[model samples]
Target chain A: MYITWMLAEGHTYKQMLPTTPGVFMGEMIVVTVVGADKPGIVAAISSVLAEAKANIVDISMTVLRGFFSMIMVVDISGAVTDLTDLRDRLERKGDEVGVKVMVLHEDVFRYMQKI
Target chain B: MTKYDASELAEIIEMLSFQHLDIRAVTMGINITGALRYDDLGEGVREIVEKHARGLRDAVKEVSSKLGVQIVTKRVAVTPVSVLLDAKAGDLNEAVRLGVSVAEALDSAAADLGVDYVGGYAAFVESGYSLGDRGVMESIPEALSSTERVTAMVNAASTLSGINMDAVYEMGSIVKETANLTGGRGCTRLGVFANAPEGTPFVPGAYHGRGEEDPVINVAVSGPGVIENVVRSLEDADLRTLHDAMKRAAFKVTRLGELVGREVANRLGVKFGSVDLSLAPSPAVGDSVADVLRAMGVEEPGAPGSVLALAVLTDAVKKGGAMATSSVGGLSGAFIPVSEDLGMAEAVRKGSLTLSSLEAMAAVCSTGLDMIVLPGDVEEHVIAAIIGDVMALGIVLDKSLGVRLIPVPGAREGDEVDFGGLLGKAPVMPVGRFSSKALVMRGGVVPPTVSRLMKG
Candidate 1:
């Protein structure tokens, strides 16, 4: 743990550890990938998020007869990139990989499914 | 512990992105009854703008951002202005001027607050027009045409009051005059209703009724595509199984409404009014009530089994929605607006859905003749007769119904016109070029039916 100072406006100012540049942070979001069944779909999706410094917390993928479907819960709080930027970049990557990608905040899932 | 798991998350994402699950509108109904007590109209308008406009845009933005679900429309429904104009004389010129001025004030306030539509520039005359009702009625055309955001309605009939043919006849000409003024666009802002409710969040039919004494939040839920997808998946579902499937789907949709609506109201410090579980459609392919009807065995929306399918769909939705939330009001059924629903538009293009068929469908569903564009040459009296026929249906069956017909200028039958955006693109449907001049000319109030007398 690093020393942190509390500011008047309720924001934290943290001093960095000697070796690490960015602190470990997480923001849970659901990502859905759907397209024709093919190889390298997972790698194609993960590479874009990974390049943006997003962490894949959980993932599931399956092929239904011919079409492929993948769902991932990722943490992007550690990324320097904004959520909107990462979403657009991932969508562009999906277009190249011949799949449809959708990224939504995890609250949508929690609100709809549980209660 | 968090509420949803992996499977539920995937399902929600699919419905949201592809199946068109969304919150249609969060209409905040504010009571402007006290405004009438003020001597000056400007003072009244000032008080209203002050009370309602503050922190509205910020509240909506904050709630929408916090929830992550899009609150697509923000609207305000004020108490009917006709009540305020009642103390004045029924002079037509004065009425129009007052209408335009009041509308300008409301429109400016709404624009300032970043609200989309300001409803309840309306008058109710189910039996006969009061002096103020007459004043507001005569000014509706000028009022609606002059304002950008203010929408209005006239309840020409109700279950107890029966059909007011006199008011219906007047509205027909008002509709025609409004269409002329705005090139068939202003009519979109007007709604003529039978048995209109006080809590409908959707416009132009929404108004803060006399029954409501305080501010309230009404939520209109959207998701025809999700139910359509579910119905399509169950290819072999019988009527019983289909009903069950729809109930289950509606339950989920309305639950989302309840959750989001209550949170929004709580954040805004207003009372949570109701979750109107209407499967409202937009121009998008997947977000169509007609598509849901198609999935329920109707090859076309106005075909033989269309009414039955609509009945089943409407009943199942009401049941599910009622169970999901304690307070459910408004037109809580599937909307069959031609331009708004892609499937319905296609049905019109294929020549399967006719104007008469739409009237028949409206008898079972929520609104009548909504977003249907007619040829430019259609007679004004014929338009009134169309409304008259629908009003008659409402009187007999005792259900809420309305008409939002647009007689496009210079457009003939089968010629497509694009209003663009959520108003969508629509092909002009034929209105048969018939004249109802004599019927409209002899307009007297249609007396209450035997059903009205039977209420013991």
Candidate 2:
């Protein structure tokens, strides 16, 4: 169950706070969310990641041909949960909000993309 | 700072999931020339084993975990065993035994360290055969047959020294003898090169040259399938657009290679060598340089426009790869190895790609007659002539080229030979029935080109 709240910027977010503290420090994961173009999707995803103390190091989101897509490199060093556990929490939020979420180690994106 | 938006991110995902994009090989070049002086050969082998044991294992673990990508094949290339034969002092039989023992030790050590292949069981006789070169040359047949992972190469031709037809002829016979000894398996591990590079990271040809550092890390990045997908998506795009897009793709691929290579080198405390951007293909369907060529509007590889297409593709890849990394080396061009490339194999199977056309492509591309399977009845002289022809191209163009032909014993023309995995499969193609016995039997070196002598 997700509780919704509105910010001063006229954006809505879900409350999915981290349940634990300091779970694998100095690690990162790449998160990608893709689904129908809709409001509150970014807010929902960011809220979940922030609640888990995952710092977004890099992010690129764009809507193409009426479909919403986003890719974020998040430092999960201070995460309160294991990577897969955090991914599971994000997936639940994704399910509730009607989007697809994929979580993988940041190295995957780094190996395929950056130098 | 490297921001990949939706489309670019999708491209990476799709390439990895469907197109089979991955690092082909991360070959570590180790200089074992210093190992030759030990009274007991076992001491040299132990030194090699100890040096590589922790370094390679730790790097592989950390890189795979941190980068979240497979390193694919872990390989080792050492100094050519021909140089080590100096210790044997003109004893051919004793050198052969020593070569076998050294190769077995190296192979066992490599296997123990979880390496895929160990190269540099080689003879460098581009000008003329030295005693040590001859010893290693004679031992190649047994050495390769006796070991699982040892790769051998013979540099029988180079631009400066011209073609050593004498060594070339012997290599042809040695190739046949190796096949006979190992039932065509050994020939796959042996390559004949002209102008072989000092920093090559790819197998059957890579060796720790005398000029290189004590130990270095070289990475070979491959993504023929990725390039194919990118090219195919732009249907009816102009040639310039196609070339530009392919360049962009290669730049990204090579960047990733440089990143991984540097990180691995830093962790292992060895200098980073080069990122080889050869579009090496596998047996898989979409992962072929021929597929990329086909996407460039060639109906089939080895067709009339195929050579030009390959030239453009090879040049564009180099331009992109050059911009991506400073230390780019090895055979950095599109490879049309027949057996290893699915589309090339299909082209051969359909009778669209012929031996002559493949040679023509090799003239413009990197290696020549790579992984081509020929009929068992093909004479030794004919094979020598084939190597001579490719060597002449490398000699004239002053570029690196190699030939890896497997004459499948008992297989006739149109017969299929399967070596499995990266060795892939090829259909035995017919060579000219005519023999060049007299020419090969000349057993003399072709002098350096006039251009070579003119270099003051």
Q: Using TM-score as the measure, which candidate wins?
A: 2
Please state the error at residue A92 of candidate 2 in Å: 14
> Candidate 2 lDDT, tens digit per residue, B180-281?
888888999999999999878888989988887778888888789889988988998998998999998888778778878888898988889999988788
> Scoring model 2 with DockQ, what do you get?
0.24
Q: Please, what are the lDDT tens digits per residue for candidate 1 over residues B1-456?
A: 243444566667667766878888888888876766676664676477658656667777666654456778888888877876775445766665666677777888888788899898888899888766776788877887778889989999998988888888888788888888888888788889998998999999888987763688888988999899889989997999999988888888988888777877788788889888888899998899989999988998889989999999998888888787888889888799999889999999999999989988997888777999988777778888999998998889888899999887788999998888778988999987566789877888888778898885
RMSD of model 2, in Å? 5.1
TM-scores of all candidate predictions against the true structure: 0.85, 0.87
Q: Once model 1 is optimally superposed onto the true structure by TM-score, how far is the C-alpha of residue B108 displaced, in angstroms?
A: 1.4
Model 1 lDDT, residue B138, Cα: 83
- lDDT measured at residue B360 in model 2 versus the true structure, 0 to 100: 92
Candidate 1 chain A least-lDDT 10 residues = A1-10
TM-score of chain B of 1: 0.96
- Top candidate by DockQ: 2
lDDT for model 1, on a 0 to 1 scale?
A: 0.80
